[model samples]
Target: MTKNHNSQHKDLMLQNSQKLDRLLTRLCKRSGCDEEEEHEGGNESVLFIAAKNGVLEILEKILKDKPGAIHETNSLDQNVLHVTVENRQPRVFEHLEKYLKEKELWESHVARADKDDNTILHLAAKLSRYKPRHIAGSALQMQWEVKWFLFMKKKMPHMQFLQNKSRKTPQDIFVRDHEDLLEQGIGWLKSTSESCSVVAALIAGVAFATATTFPGGTQEETGKPYLERHPAFNLFAFTPLWALFCSITSLITFLSILTSRQQPQDFRKDLPSKLLVGLSYLFMSIASVLASFSSAFFFLLRDHLQQVVFSLYAVAILPIAYFGVAQSPLYMDLMRATFRNIPQSSNRESEKLIL
Candidate 1:
């Protein structure tokens, strides 16, 4: 037997299952060759190897051949599910776990411990010990950790309180391992909240000034604004007042975020909740500020309506439309994602986020 065959077959499974099938056909015809046969030093059976590498099809096929192979262990005595999580193969774990349940071995397979008495839940939380390259941002990294923790809590409620040989529960391990990630998450959340607050403050200042300054100047004796008799001037007065209100609300909302306690748990609902409401108020302020500008400008140029006023209004409303058009999709996504009630049992991937 060429030593290259097992290594070659493993590589084949990773790249193309079709090519692996062709290679398996030839390998199976030869004498004394088998997928389940272990290599030297009790290295790894094909089943454990596939799970570690996330070759789901090969893992499934090997299990089909020997139903009891679900209980097979590696040199470290870690079963396939443990190996899958240890190697950071979450997708593999999902598929493999479901398969074990289908085969009526969920209890036996998931409960098995490794040499150190660390079960699959331990391996899942163990992921926080190292930062993976694919999870790019700190906030998202914290979210991923929460997602894993929740999944494990739902799957094995007893596992939360179960301590390993190191005497650390899974939650304890997460808190210990993800200290840096948690700090970064706080920094990112505050930075985002403060930036939005600045925009809200500027809007508040401008709208307040616009509300106090009458467009056509005040009447000489009564001290009431000129053009107050015109119906459009009421709109001119009210829109800026409306804008000022929304801007103040937005400013207050974002300021509260800066003062909030920056906990990892806050990111799940509290932070996103504030962000959604703040953005909504800011968007309202921006639209109303533009409306106020349009109405006031219209009052000044009302005499020129036939010639230049229509063109001027269209030119002025561009910024409001631009702000609306640009931010609507993001606004909609935040509203939907932050408020939706996802079940605890389901493993949900985070949505594509924009900041």
Candidate 2:
């Protein structure tokens, strides 16, 4: 049912896009103006608005009908590339790249600056007014911002050192524009680390206590666990040990994130990777702890209350399953932010946009 609804929604969007394209085409013809020409009231041109909002279909249709529209600029003297970069429209920028490459106008088009002498790189350095809906936290957002800046820097290395009217280079502009985001990212990382570290410490302590205290006590003569010969004994013996190791590792990983330098560059990979590791190990420790408890319960009830063991297992699994389900989105986002390739031409063939 959901799939059908989504398909219907997509079809509606497509139909609307086609209607918009026709309306724009007719409006251009009637006004005897190019698609790049601004309205009488200084409103943005259809092409620039499409690029800014990431309306790829509309932008493509206009560009296809009027190939020269790609060169048109807004009132600020910012071209399509500048507008796309400033608004963080990767798909539009990628489509424009294809057009530029086909026309053999890469150098001439990409090097153009706006009225403020801000190149595409400079615009990319500036943070967009709105955060992307798909990205979650400030730290991941900063990572994406860094990735975009680096991607553009790779595309036009010669322009990296170019200064705007304010005599600030792209790197300088990035630093100046992103100071608040950087601080937010640091606070986010530290807060997350502190919270997770406390949980990890608690899990480590529980696992340690469980491991030290044998189930059913020790036999008087041999000093061995009374339940050592039971099938469930192995689970009770090993799971707490595993849980202990995993919790300790998780705690250390979170501690590392807390003590990190928290630089802008660190958010690109280091901090996120550490957080991912810490999270994964913490989950493992939780699962192991649950398993150890279940196994110990089973060891005690194996003979007299065998049927009750299944109920106990079910009860033990609910929390772990709930935790996994609840945190899956964050885990997935962290994994993508940590390991996903930064989009650039060098790796363009293999790079898939996470945005």
- Which regions of candidate 2 fall more than 4 Å away from where they truly are? 1-18, 21-41, 343-355
* Candidate 2 accuracy as lDDT: 0.82
Clashes within 3 Å, all models in order: 0, 0
What is the alpha-carbon lDDT of model 1 when measured against the actual structure?
0.71
lDDT of 1 by residue, 235-306 (tens): 888988898999999999988888988676676667767878888899889888888888887766767665
Candidate 1 residue 65 C-alpha distance from true site, Å = 6.7
Report lDDT (CA) for all predictions: 0.71, 0.82
Ten residues in sequence with the least summed lDDT for candidate 2? 346-355
Q: List the residue pairs that clash in candidate 1.
A: none
